[model samples]
Structures are given as C-alpha cells and as structure tokens.
Target chain A: DVKVTQSSRYLVKRTGEKVFLECVQDMDHENMFWYRQDPGLGLRLIYFSYDVKMKEKGDIPEGYSVSREKKERFSLILESASTNQTSMYLCASSYGELREQYFGPGTRLTVT
Target chain B: AQSVTQLDSQVPVFEEAPVELRCNYSSSVSVYLFWYVQYPNQGLQLLLKYLSGSTLVKGINGFEAEFNKSQTSFHLRKPSVHISDTAEYFCAVRPGSNMLTFGGGTRLMVKP
Candidate 1:
C-alpha cells in the first residue's frame, strides 16, 4: 500500500494569516492533488500537479496556490487565510491518470 | 464536467444488519467510480473503485458496489456492519481524467 504523509494534522491561524500545508508520497506517483473537504461540499479540488514544476488550477483555486519543487513533496499555500478556509485539507497521489489515488492523513485548519 | 450524487445524507442501521448507501453520477464520457470512507477526525480512505471490465467491485471492510451504467448509479452495500463502520462515506467519479468530482457524502451510523 502507498503511504502519503501530511506535515500537520491540525492547524490554527488568524484571518489574513498565511498558511502552508505540506504532503509527501513515497509511491513516486506522477500526479498529485490538493483538495479542501467541507461539511456539504464534499471534496473540492484546489490545485494539482502532473509533474515536478507543473501545476493546474482546479474548480476552487481562488485563495490557494501550490508548489512542487520535489517529486515526493507537494505543498499547498494560502496567500491570506480566512475563516472560510477553515476546513480539512486532503492530498492525493496516483501513478497515472484515472488510477487509484492514495491520500494523505489530511490537515484540519481552523482559521479564526 | 463530472458530478456525483449521494441519495441519503445519513443512514442508521443496527449492528450486524445489512446496509446500503446510494450513489449516482453524471458524466459525458467514461469515468471511474470510487467510494471513500472518513473516520472521525481522520483523512479520507479509499474503500473501492470501479475502473472497467467488471460491474461489481469489492473493497475493504467487506464492502461492495455494482456499477449500473444505464442507471448512472454505483451504490455501496455491506451484509453486516460493525460499530467501527460508523463513519462518513463519500462517492466520487473521475472522468477518465486525473481530477475527481465528489458527491456531498453520506454518514453511516451502525448502532449496537
């Protein structure tokens, strides 16, 4: 089984604060994704990386950005966190398109 | 664009009883279907996936789902549920592409 690790399990931040969420996958998958999970919204993609130094914006990428300087690591960045951004963030990786995606443990962010 | 719909927002079943969670999806092209489980305060875990070839797919925790293409549905089922099975279940559909579109999710409560 592939193991994906997130840097933090819980995070707290004040409004307008910059926050960073990190993820690492040991599977050496080619595709990485970042999503925000909410009560009714399920999981909405924020950004995704198909390869190192490559990224694409998902449906809700307004306040989120991503960085992929390394193959095993992918990071999500919040330029200015807001109360609305307080949710669980998930990271997933897959070896190829439409393959089974392995997810990280997730980070629960509380923006006050 | 792909979309998934989970019919029941919450389902309550007694321990050792059969349970079913309904899921429907819409996509123009071929898509992969998946069910994910999220435990309390934990990240989402992949329960099962339907890629191709077979209509019935088995997953972890003795869960199974059948892909009904004509009905546009992929419902999850389990003969007997345990107390530990109480959690949030999410239905997701990927349009043969990398990104996945998820349903609103259904919470399953197995009581003793």
Candidate 2:
C-alpha cells in the first residue's frame, strides 16, 4: 500500500506565528501537492511541486508557500498564521505516468 | 485550465437504496477523471478512476463511475449503500498534467 504521512494530525497556532506542516510519501512519487479543505468549499490546491526545488501555485496559494528539498519530503509553510487560515490541510503524491494521487491523513490547523 | 462541478452538495439515502452523485468537468483537452471518498476527519481515498478504454470503471467498496465524453460528465453510482458508506465524495479532473481540479464535494448520508 502507498503510504503518505503528515507530521501532525492536529495543530494550534497563535496569530502572526509561523507554522510548518510536513508531508512524506514512501512511494517515490515525483509529484506532490498541498491543499486546504473547508466545510462547503471542498479541497482547494495551495501549491504543488513536480521536482525538487520546483514549485507551482495552485488556485489558492496566497499566504502559503511550499518546499520540496528532497524527493520524499514536501513541506507547507504558513508565513504568518491567521484565524482565517484555519482549515484541514492535506498532502498528496502521485507517480508520473499514472495520475492517481495518494493522500496523507491530513493536518487540521486551528489559528487563534 | 480544467474545472469540475459537482451538482449536488448533499445526497441522503436510506440503507440499501441506490444513489448517484453527479459530476461534470470543463476542459479544453482530453481529461482523466477520478472519484475520491473521505471519511470524517480523514484524508481523501481514491475510489475509482477513468483514464482510458472502457467508459465504465469500478472501484473499491462497490462504487463505480461512468465517463461520458459527450456530456462531459462522470457520475458515481452504487446499487445499494450501507451505513458505512456515509462520507464526502469528490470528483476531480486532470486536463493535461499532474495537477487535478476538484469539485465541491457531495456529502453522502446513509440513514437506516
């Protein structure tokens, strides 16, 4: 089974603090993605990386940045946490040929 | 750019009742379609995918989706649902590359 693991299942951050969410995949997939899920809006992409050190913005990338220093690791950074940024964050990875994405257990962040 | 639209926000069905969750996509090129299910407080799991060949594709947990190129729709269906099937279903489309555009999820509530 493909395994995608996130650093934290739940996190609480204070306003104006920096937050980091980590994701790792064991399948050696080349593509990694970060998304935030809200109640009715579903999941919206924040950022994606096709290769190490290369990142692309998704639909909702504002106030978020991503890092891909290694093939197996992808990190999402909230430069300054705000209450509006509270949501369930998800990470996914997929192999090149097959577009099927495997997801991690998600990190629910609460900013207060 | 590719986009997905899920027609229903919620679909409540009784146990053993048939159900259908509609999804439609808009894209300029050929696309890959997928259905993902998410249980409460968990990440998304791949239920089925339509890459090529046969239009009808079956997935895990007795779920299936048919890809309709003419109508630009990929609707998920189940002959009978169980209480365990209650979850949020997301329909996603990949237009050309690894990036996937997701639709607003349809929450499936199975009541006894």
Q: What does candidate 1's lDDT look like per residue over B1-112, in tens digits?
A: 7789999999999999999999999999988899999999777888999988889999999999999999999999999999999999999998866589999999999999
Pairs that collide in candidate 1 are none
**Across residues B8-91, which tens digit of lDDT does each residue of candidate 2 receive?**
999999999999999999999999999999998788999999989999999999999999999999999999999999999999
How large an RMSD does model 1 have?
Answer: 1.1
Isolated chain B TM-score per model: 0.98, 0.98
Per-residue lDDT tens digits of candidate 1, residues A1-112?
A: 7899999999999999999999999988999999999887799999999999999999999988999999999999999999999999999998978677888889999999
Error of 2 at B4 (Å): 1.1
Interface root-mean-square deviation, each candidate: 1.1, 1.3
Quote each prediction's TM-score. Answer: 0.96, 0.96
Docking level of model 1:
medium
RMSD of model 2, in Å? 1.1
Task: Give the best candidate by DockQ.
Answer: 1
Candidate 1 chain A — worst ten consecutive residues by lDDT sum? Answer: A96-105
TM-score of the first chain of model 2: 0.98
